[model samples]
Target: MSAPCDNQTGGPERPSFVTDDELERALRDAFARRVATPRPLAADPAGLAVRRARRVGRRRTLTGLALAGVATALVTTGVAQLGAPAGRDGTPIVVLGDPRGSSPSPLPAESTAAAPAAGPVRPELDLIVGSWLYTNGGERWELTGVSTVERAQRVPDRGGWLLTSAVTAAGRTLWWVPPNGRPPQVLLAGADAIAVAADGRRVAWRDGGEVFAAGAVAGQLLATTRAAAPAGAVPVGFAGDTVLIRQPGRGGFRVWHSPTEDRLGTVNRDVLNVYGVRPDGLVVGQVSAGTPRRPCLALLDPARELAPVRTGCDPELATDGRGDVSADGRWLLVNGARNAALLVDLDALGSGGSGQSAGPALTGVVTWTRAGAALHVDAAGALVRVRPEEVTAGEQPFSSPVDGVAPGDRPVVVADSRP
Candidate 1:
């Protein structure tokens, strides 16, 4: 009778991480006579096939994910680019092989006081502190200007949200490295809510109950807070620095949150994958708490305001891209079943060709990022790394790894900054 979880860090949104055969079998029986598999993407080709069910599959069996990927290959959105590989939907996929991602901290969250008005806590901004990519050989990015609040109102300094700060920055640094704290007894630092930062000066992590930020010391705890959630909150997923969770207030609802447990947006609708959350704040979920039928994918917003995204891409590909985007919020590098892939910018207008041209070929699911928006194509000895800010519009923007090597083949994150 409680709300379902939508945490991106593979929370309830993904069912139970105990992806063992037992859990799978239990989940299977729960919906044995009620669930129905949807058609494959190959059938509609351009259109993505939407399946309906209360839960995709037990974490033990990502039957939905496997089948979904299988459908992607069979159906390509035959839609060409405006200028070939320039900005084929600028997206940033989840960076696999994240060094610090090695050890998951705990889950962070706040209790919903006694009453709803007992002062519901709000969310704040989460910053990247340390990681293998940054410490090894990359640029460090900081997350600042975040605070907590109630509802969708901005408080900026409610003091309930968590925050992290650094004293300096390094030119070649990739992430921050701390000194202590790593266990699963409480919450597993699984998935990602993990990163050290490119400057190698900060520490950020999710400690299950709530998010925490620190400077040079791991146990030094910078700040911590809970999500703008009700008493019965369900975690769906975690994206970039955000967490997707569901709770029961007036009724069942969904929303995006920060590591410190702050609400960024909300989805007041019903969906099937209520258990799914993408990276870019886009939710691939559903809620039938008060409804009478099975579940389906529903795009949710943090504030339950307007439609989530309407750009050239949106609700688009959260999982790095689609089922993908619900977590990272980009599509530059997406994760696939076999290999990681890239979303190449197709310029049908300029390249003067109708077919795919010579540029970059992502080896994984296409992912993207907004700040350092660069097209990284790792394929066929052609490393296309183009910073969108540096090029002119329609320049067939592309980027390949140093040697056109598929980074997907080997999760690379600028590691080497060790003792």
Candidate 2:
């Protein structure tokens, strides 16, 4: 009736339907008896071993592929970081330090406006006015504990940048200006002369014919070598791992490689004053040429074997060892005549003619502030920026403690920015 309720009724007591093929399979499986067959105990052992080995090889291959994929991902991540902005390049902004107990002043606040899309912000010039160190912004930082600063140099060491100063007090001392603005650390208490690596990672100082080497950070001494420096010898600079030293009036400078303290070489046998050392391992100095009163600037290789490259004889273009070579080693500025300053590209210093015009004659000492410019300190303690294009000098709102400077204010030393 009604086609047997369509085998599976839509009513409550519905019957389950089974196909003939399924019923047959189920019946066969329930009634069929399996035949007993002997399985080979250990078929060809070598064949089995080969099959097992193949499986292991496949597993190893898959694992290696996975590892390779991970490695590729890691390398890709590193490459991406490499392309990130210079802010990730480990470069640091310039900062100021004080010798007195005062901490390092905080860096200027980052501008809220969009930053310029450019490479690193070039460091500006730093000034050492009397016992005070002034930032480019005219902030007067006290050089608290130290007395008189003979020479000041901003150093970029491995640990961090430091403001390295050679101080003259009871005796010569080497003071370290921490980038964090911590109180100045005494690198060497009793030191006659000091030389810092342009990178600011290493320092070498001489005290009574003995030389000591240390890391830029405050800590124990790195090494000591007896008779490393001669009497009255000052650490002029560092050329790579070698330390260059010379007396005030010595005809030349000698080089001593650190750790081993081996004599590397001597340069400028007849040159009088070794002025500045470039980061590229070149040295600048003055030598007697033409006449005793007439001196010429010389570009010399720190290696003794190289001959001195002298500027064409210029009597007025004399240097008082009061100048600096640009961190890039492309520019050099030295004090010329009393009212004039000397400017020369290091690349062309060897070929320039005598008495080449280097801009207006500036009074007082001309100390390099940046690359192609020099900070001319007038007799009245006023600082004027002299460049290849123009001069920026005048009375402005310089931070206090400077007090617009007093009559006694003088530029005892200069601590300028470096690459």
Candidate 3:
């Protein structure tokens, strides 16, 4: 039998299949031959990889340069926007953020840019120009002009200056210094007292008991009108067209209509003295005796028969008839007890708030500027600038020794026009 005939009469059935071990050996040999024979490469594989890397680096470098250009353009635009236009004379206008003298240093990589340096502090037009007049060393001096008179008053509108000189046995001679730099002209020969309007357009003076009102124009008086004032009345100031006359030995003031010569009304007798008048015709006064009994600063409305519009009382408030309101009628600075000054916010007072003590304990007088800064001449003759907004109790204002003023010399500032 051919291998015992696996199937019925199959003659060894079929060719014998390979064993499992033999098949595994054949597969391993095939794999070994395929690995031994090297495959064909399109190019040097290592060189191709290096070239690809170089191309990617070039692309990254180009992208970095493009981003830097965009950043530079944005910075240039920002600088142009911050710059201000030049003046007509080709001088650059001084703006708030412009660098002074030298360029600023660059900021650190992680730090934010610092705030711009503050510009130099400058006085307002009333303080800068010819308005500031003071006396020093027995000689008078205009802040911008030469020493000329013993006392000077600036016109509120900068029309000119009212100067007092030649005090004779008769009375004080009033002179008008024209704003155009012309020689001063004589305004009145013998004026006992003088008061200028808030607008500097009208002027009133007293020759004995007779009060006169005239239009102040170009350093000359026009349209003069005269009216006999109440007995013992002295011209103090002008509230619009009305003339404010204080009666000596009396505790109140009287309002006189200059044009009509009609005695309008009287301020309340409770107001001990009229310190000053605001631009809006409100009178600032002191009430020494009242229901509260404490000395207080009272803002009186003349239209309402001098009724108290607002009152701020403090035991330390001592008014020696030296006080003023800001031109905008917002601030009131009154002389206080112990040589200090009190700053009252009219808005706050109207809303029922208290006053604040301002500046150092100055031995000298405190006056307000048209720009609302309190000007105080300290004991050391330092011209101190007190900002009302910055003033707090027991705080000192900025003090600077004025040039040409000695350390011990006290300078008296011109009044009324500064309100």
Model 3: per-residue Cα lDDT over 1-419, one tens digit each? 43565556656644569775665566555654656447754455444555676677787787679758855864665422212122223211112111222112332322132321321133332221122332221222222222323345667665666665434565555666545433345555556666666566777776654677777665545555667666566676777777777766755777777777544465456666666677667887776555757577777776666678877664356656666677777887766776776677776664556667776555534456656777756667666777876785456576775554433444445544543
Worst 10 residues of 1 by lDDT: 146-155
**Which wins on TM-score, candidate 1 or candidate 2?**
2
* Candidate 3 structure lDDT: 0.57
Worst 10 residues of 3 by lDDT: 90-99
**Local lDDT at 97 for model 1:** 20
Using TM-score as the measure, what is the rank order of every candidate, best first? Answer: 3, 2, 1
Per residue, candidate 1 scores C-alpha lDDT tens digits across 33-63 of: 4436654333431112112222333432565
Model 1 error, position 192 (Å) = 8.4
Report the C-alpha displacement of residue 413, candidate 2, in angstroms: 6.9
Report the C-alpha lDDT of model 2 over 214-246, residue by residue, as the tens digit. 555332233333344555667767767667667
C-alpha local distance difference test of each model: 0.30, 0.52, 0.57
Give residue 38's lDDT in candidate 3 (0 to 100). Answer: 77
TM per prediction: 0.29, 0.57, 0.58
Best by lDDT: 3
